[model samples]
Target chain A: MSRATILSAILSNQPQTTQLPEDLQFDCPAKAAVTEKFIQMINLIGGRVVEIQRIEDINLYATAHYGAGERLITPIEELDFYTQFAGDEDPHQFENIAFAVFKTHFAVAENGAVWITEDRMGARVLPFICQHLGMLVFEDSIVSNMHEAYQLIGSQDYGFGTFIAGPSKTADIEQSLVLGAHGARSIIIFLLKKEL
Target chain B: MSSIKHPELSDIFNKDEERVNWHDDTLWWIRAKRDKAAHGISEWELLRETASQIKNNVLSNLHNYLIEFEEKAQKNGIKVHWAANAEEHNKIVLSLLQGKGINQMVKSKSMLTEECHLNEYLESNGIDVIDSDLGERIVQLAKEPPSHIVLPCIHKKKEEIGQLFHEHLGTEAGISDPQVLTETARIHLRKTFLTRRSALTGVNFAVAETGEFVVCTNEGNADMGAHLADIHIACMGIEKLIPKKKHLSVFLRLLTRSATGQPITTYSSHFKKPRKGQEMHIVLVDNGRSVQLGREDFRNSLKCIRCGACMNTCPVYRRSGGHSYHNAIAGPIGAILAPNLDMKEYADLPFASTLCGSCTNVCPVKIDIHDQLYKWRQVIVKEGYTSSAKTVAMKVMDFTLSSPTRFKLAGKIGRWTLKHAPFTVNNRLNLWFKNREMPEAPEESFSEWYKRNNSI
Candidate 1:
């Protein structure tokens, strides 16, 4: 077949196998539980959590959220805020945020790690931005190694994907272990109950 | 015009032994970063191998893949252009801008543009181009090419950058802090980003399966420029394609770790389809790459992901500096690749290295950069492309080294002369003695010492 036809056939078949998971549904009790879970998850990932009654109210953690309050929300805004904030304050804050919230299909509970598809986050930046990142995962999605993670995702979709383990940890300066030089400092996994 | 050699800068390498040491340390620092990031994942080496194989497949099937990418891109309302050479690439890009009647453009970091000198070409044709990436902008303001690929203006000190920002961006004249300087560039480029009608970017990888191109940058400049511009142009060489999306996982794993030691770039953007009312174009430039592909021994050089891991790990590139290579690209990888584009013009570049294998060792995709440099030296010598002085020296050495008696006699006389007359052998005028002290001759030569010690 012609390359165009082959590509179209590939792309047309893509959505069939790889639909974005359906909008998550939650009961009132489940919602309350998830909220608490999210706060606990954030704390687990090294972010100090402050509760706000409404989403509009700025939890100092939320108001000071890197990309949250921007007029023109280009992907660049989030990236700019993180780059400057990382260099100025704790560099790992942005990375920790990126690790926490950006959607992930897989999580490794053993190490409190997250495996993100490239589609949910832009190629590399999503994993590096955000001070405290929250990863939403179905309980059954946990994997032992990246090899199994790759097999489960298959080979068709996602422009680029990465398996990020924990936050930006480094031993670069004089072999002194420095956690989070440029990427996430901590990764929090929120394992959701699997749907029937 | 006579090869544009930088003999003056060569003195820096010759004078300070410390230059080599600093170079080694800087590269090793980057190398250490790579190790730290790679060790985080258990399958890191396997991923590197997979990425390498995928790229190899792309290169072997490049001609077909380009045709495939062009057809799909065209169907998606994206214009695809082919340039057989650098001059052709420049002409194609200029004509595209001219066709749109756009005279101003904001560009993200595209090394292909650097290779084609796109900004200079566009300026000559009266199109003003602004580099949006802070590192690129700094190098552009300094009127110098990028010294390093990922960190373009890495050679510039913070004070120099502060001064540049002060002059151009109206920052406080005395402030020399990096954070302040970077913020100034950020504010300045924001205005350029909003105003420019067109944007151009370089492709990190182009997936054939999606007809999408990926760009990774620390700053989100590429995404900002593409999102705001009416027209988006992405320039890439034919060698950038990989077979599938899952393969990207492998490359993404290796690229950032090898480049900046980050787990991932701050922004890795995938432009699958143009936004509403935006025109997307992909320009594939050959620029002697096809000829490079034809050479069996040197073809693997094309497999470079341009992570610059090789440059960061190369002892020669760090000491000699990027400008010494005299090309848009530099370092050990550049030394081998530059000669393919212009052998006689870049004859000195390949010989500039010490043939250390650190570049090969640190390369994520495992490009045999040092070996390629060695092969290029052979090609240059065989083609009679070297300087007359070098040619004469090589021939004289070759004649002496071939004869055992002559070699032994020359060594004995050299030791006798050095021991008898210290000043004659050691002087500032001698290039080898400029930085390194000639060791004081012992009472006897190594051969004499060995012979006497063993005999006793």
Candidate 2:
């Protein structure tokens, strides 16, 4: 069988294993100013960021930006929503969601990415299927770089999680940057200063 | 000089000088972007070094990690399969789909599948496969292999893509706007993602510690397909494994920065387990990787992250185009790798380089690409894989160079013939003269000129 042959080949062919490097530390740019760097990175990645003093301000902004007719959905109990889905909710039902407002566990300032796990999202498809996405990240829950970001989530277990930096994009056609290729067209991260 | 694959194919690609220049300039622009991103990070070199070391460790302990990854992944409700070769890999995928009675599948960009020719294999076995990545879909519709790994259709022009889309996706004729065309592909692929019961993705990094895999994409197609589909299959090369989850930080940081100057891909999705009711399968394909591992000099190539940085910075790759390499993977990495798969078939690939070392510098994992290309040439020639005529010519040149009198006489005769009858050396039969002009022959050879000047 290929398995036995492949494993034996790998075992026999491998040279002496070397020790991994000790405690690799990186001096990321966001170490000094997390929010400032996060804003700069988010803009660089073609995503907008809004600083909201109050958590409730997001609903008003979403409604004002998307208007009242758009199908806005949020799993956060405190915020306003048009649809609330259960744990066992079908992801296909949210195919027409216009706005998906979800809470991100943490934000990486170096890349402007917000960590969204399956538990944070009511339906896994909501954030991706929605026309626009609003990622709610706490002001203090930001790391300097990927090193710190991975450090925080290394031990955590989840079925699925993604560090979404911006809305879906592609430069496949002659290297022309095109936004909204297959996922949310616009991504706006709201930095909530309130306690969860 | 010899009947090599890359040179023959590149000769055809070089026919369109304008397109070749455009392709070169386009990839160079990306290379510049990578430089900008790399300079932005203070610890860029450190990150590269750490990633390279981690990969070295993984390679030296690959068997243990694979076993560990399989055990943990199985515990996480993911079925793991091992395939020795491409045919076995394709058959395993086919059987999985057949077992589930799945007739159609939506797949994201998985170069492993491309390496295995999985799409063609499945199609021949009566299964329909749809490529969801915009670039992959463009090449798929054109019935062409991906020229570039990251940018599948980079060799194609916007107008050509417009025509392809107009015929396949019903886009309006002569509409070359990327924004409009991308939306059209999005709509077309969205329907496929929703309808297809099974989805396949290529694994970017498989963590042995946690038994999770990461798939990075700017379009989020992998996540969209996997999340929506009932079944998800992740095909990964044995070299994709990392020692631990913590190692991902160094790799993830280097991957997008070196690729397209992006801080991170739009979606860096981590799949640790199957979703609530979804069935996930992981296919680990050796498929010549073990043979490559056996090669001491070329084994460092297994550290590649497939970021395409090497290709972007490669002057020959940019001008000759990816298809010229004629491997599923192309460019500097492919040139070193293709020979391991079949030395005789890819004998000319290593010679397709200028050995400028730009690819070696740009590689995220620090693979000594140019050095390997140089080494592979020696290995290929030593194996007597070159044309017999070239071998005889090389032998004659070697014989003349071994003696001072013969070398001087040969040089004197060569310059004399070139000066007296330029057509004798600058004819169609001479490969060097085919695309170049012979330098003006001096009155005296360089050594003779040096001796005369010193005596004065």
Query: How far is A64's C-alpha from truth in model 2 (Å)?
Result: 0.7
Q: What is the lDDT of residue A44 in candidate 2?
A: 86
Scored by lDDT, model 2 comes in at 0.90
lDDT of 1 by residue, B372-430 (tens): 98999899889988878678888989998999888877778777777888788798766
TM-score against native, each model: 0.76, 0.97
Model 1 stretches with alpha carbons more than 4 Å out: A1-196, B1-7, B12-25, B442-456
Candidate 1 docking band: incorrect
What docking grade applies to model 2?
Answer: high
Quote the positional error of residue A175 for candidate 1 in Å: 17
- Report the TM-score of the second chain of model 2 against its true counterpart: 0.98
